[model samples]
Target: MHWVFLVLAGLAEVAFAFCLGKARLATGSESVGWYAAFAGCAALSFYLLNLSLAHIPLGTAYAVWTGIGAVGTAGLGVLAFGDPLTGPRLFFLATLIGSVLGLKAVSA
Candidate 1:
């Protein structure tokens, strides 16, 4: 399904973001793997996005993908990296979710 691929693309975007971040952190040999992962995910994300755009509106698909990617990345920051969940963070997260819902409604 396109939706499934879209979600995968979003997840892959998050993966690419994370790997690219790590690659920037590590030294020579270790960073190579990170860069490779980032590249692979980036390719997949772009491919699926292009495919989804054929059937879905570009604005809707792009918004959905990036919004979900933001939420997922923040979640990873909290759960995997022990990032703080301050009030402002929660507020932004709620706003992001709200925007996604509003977009869904408009797109529907």
Candidate 2:
């Protein structure tokens, strides 16, 4: 389904963000691999997004996709990069997620 593709694209976007962070932090040979992975993920994300857009409304699809990616990437940053998860940040993140879900429900 197109929704599946959209979700996959969002996940790919998350992976792309994580890979980009890893690539930036890495040095020597490891950096090269991370960079390559980042590029692959980015490509996959965009490709899947394009596929989803064929069926889903552009505004709805883009917002949901980016919302997923943003939340996922922020969570990963907290877990992997020791980024501070302040109360306000968590609250905003939850709000964003709720908005995404609301969009999906209404679109359906």
User: Taking the tens digit of each residue's C-alpha lDDT, what string does model 2 give over 1-108?
Assistant: 999999999999999999999998999999999999999999999999999999899999999999999999999999999999999999999999999999999995
Model 1 ranges with Cα > 4 A deviation = none
Evaluated at residue 67, the lDDT of candidate 2 is 98
Q: Identify the leading candidate in terms of TM-score.
A: 2
Each model's TM-score, in the order given? Answer: 0.88, 0.97
lDDT of 2 at 52: 97
lDDT of 1: 0.86
RMSD to the true structure for each prediction, in A, is 1.5, 0.7
